[model samples]
Target: MGEKTLPQAGQRGAIPEKQAWKALAALCIGLFVTLLDQSLVAVSLPRIREELGASINQVVWVSAIYLLTFAVPLLITGRLGDRYGQRNIYLIGMAIFTLAAFACSQAPTIEWLILLRAVQGFGGSLINPQPLSIIHRIFAHNRRGAATGVWSAVASSAGLFGPVIGGVLVGTVGWRWVFFVYVPLGLISLVMVARYVPKLPTGTSRIDLLSGLVSLIAVLAVVFSLQQGPELGWTWWVWVVLALGVAALLLFIRMQRNNPRALVPLGLFKYRNFSLGAFAVGMLGFTVYSVNLPIMLYLQVGQGMRAETAGLMLVPMGVISVIMAPVLGRLTDKIAPGLISKIGFSAMIAAMTLFGILMHLQVTPAWLLIAIVLLGLANAMCWSPNSTISMRDLPPELVGAGSGVYNTARQVGAVVGAAALGAVMQMGVDSFSFGAAMGNALLLPVVFLLAGLLAVSRFK
Candidate 1:
């Protein structure tokens, strides 16, 4: 199969490997800038709060709203890449994100910031799934792992690197600079995409607008209820909204199963690796997003570390991930992903659990670094293999749908993680020592990672 010629979407013959890789690099820059921009925002949260006079709850919305908006539109956006050209869709989304970043920096209040972040999230959703489609279209099935590895490396490393860059921006300039810092990177990504990424052929798949709206409402309801439950005292209305969200979600699933224009083609889940990959990545999303703000808050507010120092403390995560992704990415092409992901999930579980334990105990700060290192290792192993395993087997026509579903799972996990953690942290802070509150909140990710581990354990 590797020996057979596979043409690019608009070509007569095989797309040169060099051209495929160059296009992937262009996509990586866009992914990296967005992830870096978002992750860096965590380090700036305290500063954002101080300047805007936002309550801790309002602060959580800055992150949660982004994830919620980002997650809900993804299925549609994935199809957008299929129906319109990936490069064209990517350019439009990147333009929106860059403009929104500038708008976010200019926001005078927390409400404004939150609103702008939503626009930014929607833009990110458009950007996220294109790489999946383009990579699959351009790379052969057997070699997809290596291409995916490069993509995953940028994605994972960007999140890790965000804090370090964010700390510097926050410490020297201000919180607004964190958003401002990305404008140039975004512009550069736009230029590179224009220069490198090819215009792939669009598919005939029609998007299901009704299903999209239903899915959005379901996600918004659940995330809103979780985020506001503590503030609202978990009132009757909160439970009502939560229940409605669950019911609506079930309805959406049923709708997809029957609807020909389904946002998620339920049939795709029939592939075991695809199903497990989506599940595992969701757990990863839950853990990764849930842990960030709490750790930043714990270190900055609880331990009183300087923003730059605290950001620097977490740099090892990105550093380790960057060093290991290429190696592990290649490994996914040869080895059993089940074994690789097991090692990753175990490390993640240990790291988050240990973080909670030590934070609850208020142990010395140095001890926490060990957990960070584990997280880095977990990130390196989890992203590439899971991504490689998930979509490589799909028919080319289904790549966009598969990517959308896979990424939606991830962002949905992120949405739940951020919301649930916010609620937990708010409760913990009220009743316990700050460190203990953060420590307890860390356990949520453990439960998520454990679930993911069990899912991947069934992989062939």
Candidate 2:
């Protein structure tokens, strides 16, 4: 069969292994660029703030809006993939993301940057879920765990190396270069995906636009309130927004229950592992995205390190994750996924707690580097295993939907982390030194991880 004529859905047993791996590579490249953009901008935030003359809120929104837009449309986008084709939607997303990256580099003001970031995020939302869904369709059950491991490794590696790349660009060329750098990468990924990734058969399921709108409104209200609450002195409007968010969420759930074509089928939660895995991944997202900005600030602002030096400090974490992810991924196939994930969550909790304590004491670089290494190990164990087990039992036809929900949970957690942590950090800064504020903010990840641990406990 030609590249465009793939085996039908649920017929992965027939696809050639060589083509499967090539498709995996194409998907990883797409995933890498999108995830790289997520972390790459983080280290450059301070530079962007200075150049754009943005306030703290605006600076955080640069990150938050991207995540927010990325998170909200995932449910619909996943269904779109099912209706269209995963490879088709992924290519479209890559094209949009690449163009938006160029646009972001030329944005003249913070507001324009935020708007462009939102567009970039829309492209990301299109690209993010298809890889996992495609992997599920093309890879055999025996090797799916390993595929997820590779997927997780690419994501973690992006997170790890993004700051270093950003630091180099922001320090040497300019902050705008951070956005410009991804344009070429995105173009390359687009070409690879079009050439290599098989065109999977599409599903005929209709998407529920109302559920999508509700989800967007709910997430926006809640995240905006949380991010602005501390700065705004927790006014009545903040509480009002929070309440509106909660109400909208309830309405969304009710609508999902009533609609046969729900954006998120409530039935997916019937499986204990899927439910638990979703929660755990969300916690991981919260910790991973929330922790980066504070760590960058602590390194650059609090310790008086250069952007390049601060970015380099994160290299060990990435290195460790890159080394360990595949090993853990293969192990996930043999081991009880819950057990592997529990070990990961425990290690991450310990590492984050240590980071909090070390920051409180203002420890030397050596101690901090050790903590970062531990964090990397924890990350390697956490993401792939949780992802593997979450969809382990999902029906083949629902793979696209499941991937969407799983990714949506992760991104929503990220949105919460960025906003809520920003608020917490602001509060801490108001009452204490920058180091103390960051130290205090570190505790939030610990709390999120503990909650994840609780969810993982229910996995078996």
Candidate 3:
């Protein structure tokens, strides 16, 4: 009787392992295009500013608004996946994102572009959390890491080629092509998801709408203050808004604590690994999202390298990351603790420390490239293994909520990291030489990596 009813509750028990892997691949591809669009658009921003006759301030919104819309609502979207169905939410997101991309391509003005990008980003949020939940539902425990490893690898690889691809697209075909390219990829993902990914059982019954609202407002204010702070002078009002955001965030936490069926599921934190994993991922988010700024500034502005050459220097990091993620995932399936992630974070610190020293000592590009390779391997270890370990002990019922909270933490870290690094970079640039300023900024990642290392070290 249990076996007979199992297909309706969560269908993966009836899914063949080979077919489940196919579903995971399709989901990963969907994840790929969304991530690719982010890096792709970033490369096109300068051209966008030139063509649209926009100021630097207005142009930054083209990027900032997308990030704001995407990161802020992830908590809600994740629960939406559980309340509805992962496949349904993913298909809807792909359609919305694809449509937004097409609209963005034809946008006549910067304002239109910004508005459409927000739509595009919201679509992305809808797609992001579904994959993890889908993976959990379709694959059994022992096979999950290998499945997650491939997911992690493809995810890392998506950005690896983005700069090169974006540069080529923007240079040859025009900035519009960057947005146009995704129309087909999005459509393909929509079809693939429709055909390949199964609709999983909805796990969540009630969503904390009030908590979601508070979080949205608080995150919006905080992210706005941070994104605009450099331009807006961090005035008295900005400080006031920032403080209110913090207070609202605290209130959201309190609300979650009081609500038994909270969207966030505080019970997940009862497992020591989940709490530590969530924290570690946040630190990883901080480093991964912000580290690029100083490196690019150092190479392009300070060292006088061509844009192509400077972008090429980072390729080693991407290459190693792609190669190592699945291997790390396989290791994660075998190990209960985060021994691998701990070592990875440690290597990450070492890599950043070496890279920073090389920059300060004015080393050649060749040596710095080698340092980046080490950073790549370290990052590879951190991402897949850490993610696998985080969810390893999660309750089956709270999987969707866990994915939501975990990823929300990751994006929150990314948002905060980018803002923190920008502030630090600005301060350093003001007080020191170009190289010195960038070098100091580079040190920031090492500090975050230290925190990540400490988090994983406590894994038991």
Better of 1 and 2 by TM-score: 2
lDDT of 2 by residue, 1-460 (tens): 1345566434243377687788888789879888887788887898899999999889988987787777777877887888788888999998998899999999999999999999999999899999988887777776778888888888767877888998788778998988888788888888888777777777647788888899878877876776567668889989999999889989998998857788878888888899899888889888887788788788888899877888899999988887888788878888766888889999999888888888888876567987899999999999888888888678756777888888878877876787778887888999988888888888788988999998987776
- For model 3 the TM-score comes to 0.95
Model 1, span 282-373: residue lDDT tens: 99888885677898789899999876787788888888887787788778878866888888888888888889889988977788999999
- Candidate 1, residue 45: Cα displacement in angstroms equals 4.0
Write down the RMSD of all candidates, one decimal each. Answer: 3.8, 2.5, 2.6
Which candidate has the top score in TM-score? 3
TM value for model 1: 0.91
* lDDT (Cα, 0-100) at 85 in candidate 3: 80
Evaluate all candidate structures by whole-model CA lDDT and list the values in order: 0.82, 0.83, 0.81
The per-prediction tally of clashing pairs is 0, 0, 0
List of clashing residue pairs for candidate 3: none
